[model samples]
Target: MTGNARSEETLLLRSAVDRLKTALPRTWTLDLDLDPGRDGTVTAVAPDARLTIRTPSGASATFTIEVKRASRGSVRGALERLLLLSDGQPALVITDFANPALRKQCEELGIGYVDLTGWVFIRNDSAGIFVRTQGPARQAPLPDGRTTATKRLDGPGASKVVRALWDVTSTTGVRELAQRAGVSAGTVTKVLPALAAYGAVTRLRDGGVTDVDRRLLMERWTLDYKIYRTNPEVLWRLAPRGPDLAYADLLATDLGNDPTGRTIAYTGWLAATVSLPEGNYPVVPNTLLSIYSADPGALGDDLGLRTASPQTANVVLIRPRDETLLTGVPLPVPEPQIIADLMTMGGRYDELATQLSEATSVRTETP
Candidate 1:
């Protein structure tokens, strides 16, 4: 580490330890010792600092502490490095911030962590001391004066990457994923880390996506995405025929094969009715037929759909927020997107989400 960098890390560690001391019970005593002799070159051998804690009864324990100032996406890697650096001793990781997922990982690994946001977790069996605290659910600013923003899967680029993940089960390369998602490599680069943080996808050391948890990904996606809210749509009733006949007409239209070069597909309730087994979701009257289209005006005209009030509308011509929704995705959209759309509707559709999740969450073995 450079002299300035080491000095900054020292300051961070001291500030975090001070916060820990303040957060401790009145009866507890806390002391910090910086390992000045260790050059930090072989960080795997020596921790950045050591913490000594004592109870009123004089019971005490010492914990090796490693201070890391990392981005939110690197929290897991920081935790894992702390584990290696601490060996089998009682250890703690002090970072700029630690989200609940990373905190839970620390607890599961039986290690301790403290963050600048006042979040802390520590336990020592011999000392009979357990400490855990929660600060605000926000990231502190970096030394360079930038707030670490959490990545979200709500945007069109992220949506494309997410849908690509749903289609493949094998250990997929990032470039391959970009190609598969029909997005730029940069979009995949930004989205993968966020997806990993959400426990949706696992990445190898070389940054290849090795696994995907479709159910978890779908659940997390719904937290940020909504069918009606994320995508723009205009309500229209399909002539005088009901949604079924209209959906049938939609199938016959084969918009994917159109020479006009517009991408289109079914989604939500109407898509679920076709994808799910018969009777899994009954096609009741007035069920919304959601169609994603590149050009809603042209698609409505092509399909002979007319604008109607929400009460009378049986079909919705949706202009997707980005072409990612339609590009490279299967006709009728992917099952996960269908499930997400159902989840966005809430109410009775929540049950359909669960049913679709159970029906399609089968993983194919990676060769």
Candidate 2:
């Protein structure tokens, strides 16, 4: 292929990758590379972080990522090498404002350049600049004044809620997060304090919430989500229903089979009642059930079950044999707005899950 042809191909590939990333949101890993190539073809590699995007032509592009601290001259040199490897095909340089010098070089060369600033890309085409915004970055600032980064929160219910608030806040609250999270306004409020303490969310005085620190939330939630997602026992217990049996039964079976067994006494009953006029009664396990041979004393009081009532139907039974394992400073319960924020996150997770499933299916069906 001629130099111009290769550049055009690279440009096309760059545009395609950008579109894919926008459409798939946090489902892929992007790397930009520049190096010498074999034969006449310049290779470009685009790998989805979680899955692979296979090319129809049986050729995969080489993957490269331009580091933030790499100098403009270095990036320009790399781009030049990549263009040469492409046999003179026109290539678009996609980078952030961090590489001002390289961007300036691209402008001088009249080559196309995409600026990823403010979480949106400024595409300079023949006519003018076109703007495209992707999902917000999930990040939090470290105590050492550096930023921590991770995947966007697409986890369980509580985490999804927290991330939705972060995305809404980061994007100027144009997004309706509460409706998306599917959580009660009251519940969101209750969770906000815990999220705020971890710097996962920022609350605006006008009843708005934002994610001032997404990285922190990602790191913490990653651990928490894995525990729930990977543990068969935990997941089974949390599941709505398994094998026609109620979740309470499953929990009981699990407890019975536990290594500690009868050494750790267990006593609880599953309860069910209705909250709405038309809805059927939902089973609730009294998570506050106690187990003790002698006096359960101050330990029971410290368990923070003051809000418990017989009428509440969604309770889960829990007991702490070793209270030392539960030590932590209690976070203040969030206000109603926090619940609204979490609802937004839940919606995002649902949307992302749908998209990922579709993408996986498409990839599998493609030749």
Candidate 3:
């Protein structure tokens, strides 16, 4: 850590300690030891300090505190190390922001984490303490003190490049990738480093993509690119026959018939069900039929779908905001996009997304 970063971290740590003290009961006490010397057993990769929390009932718990101010990858790595500490020594990561995924990881590992924004999750059954508070989701301040906004898979260009990287297994040049994704070479150029930062794709000496962790790439995309949030949508209810018949009608529509000559493809639960082997679908019935179309109005008219409110809608027509949604991607829908849609739907759809990925051969063996 640089001198400036160290100072910032120190300030954050001190503030967090104060917040912890205020959060506890009047009788409870909290103390933070900045120079908590590490024992020989604790490797050089040690925590920053120790936080001792005392309850009114005389029960106490000392937690090894590690402060992280970077990305989710850094926090995740720290949490892994903290989890290895002896059962008696619980750990907590004080970070700038802890997204839901990282918080879930901390909870699952039986560790604790408190972000700078007052999001705290410390569950120590032994100490009879369980505390969790809500925090606003804000971008962490950079070393230069600027906040990140649109970088790292945030927009349509990122979606294009990410899909391109996932689709190809062989080492690919930037220009070629851009061509494949139907994007400018600059888009691929900008997105590759972000993917590298997330450890999603590996670049070679020539700056070409050499390997990709397909699953990690998809997960990282999910953090920034949400289907409903990114696209313009209209909800509708199909006729009395419901989604199954509508899906059939979609499949029957000729690609050549589209007035704009753009692709209209089925997605979400209905798509996953169709893609999966017969009788392999989960018990969750397919209620929502999501689709991507360049023209929602035309498609709705063609399908005879009735506009409906969100609660009663069985079909959703999303006019993709990104050209890459249909450009250079597979007909019916790209596997990664479908998987992303399923994941966003969440619940049992998450499992279905996994199965769809497997069936669709989503993984390209990294070289």
Could you tell me how far off, in angstroms, the CA of residue 36 lies in candidate 3 after the best superposition?
2.6
Worst 10 residues of 3 by lDDT: 323-332
Alpha-carbon RMSD, each predicted model: 5.2, 18.1, 5.8
Q: Write the per-residue lDDT of candidate 2 for residues 158-206, one digit (tens) a residue.
A: 5546645533534333234556665556555554544443335455544
lDDT of 3 by residue, 170-253 (tens): 889888999998889987877775555445666665668877777677887887778777776645555457877877777676
In model 1, what lDDT does residue 236 have? 61
Give the lowest summed-lDDT range of ten residues in model 1. Answer: 358-367
Ranking by lDDT: 1, 3, 2
Best by lDDT: 1
Measured with C-alpha atoms, the lDDT of residue 142 in candidate 3 is 63
Candidate 2 vs. true structure, TM-score = 0.23
> Arrange candidates by TM-score, highest first: which order?
1, 3, 2
Q: How many clashing residue pairs appear in each of the predictions shown?
A: 0, 38, 0
Judging by TM-score against the true structure, name the best candidate: 1
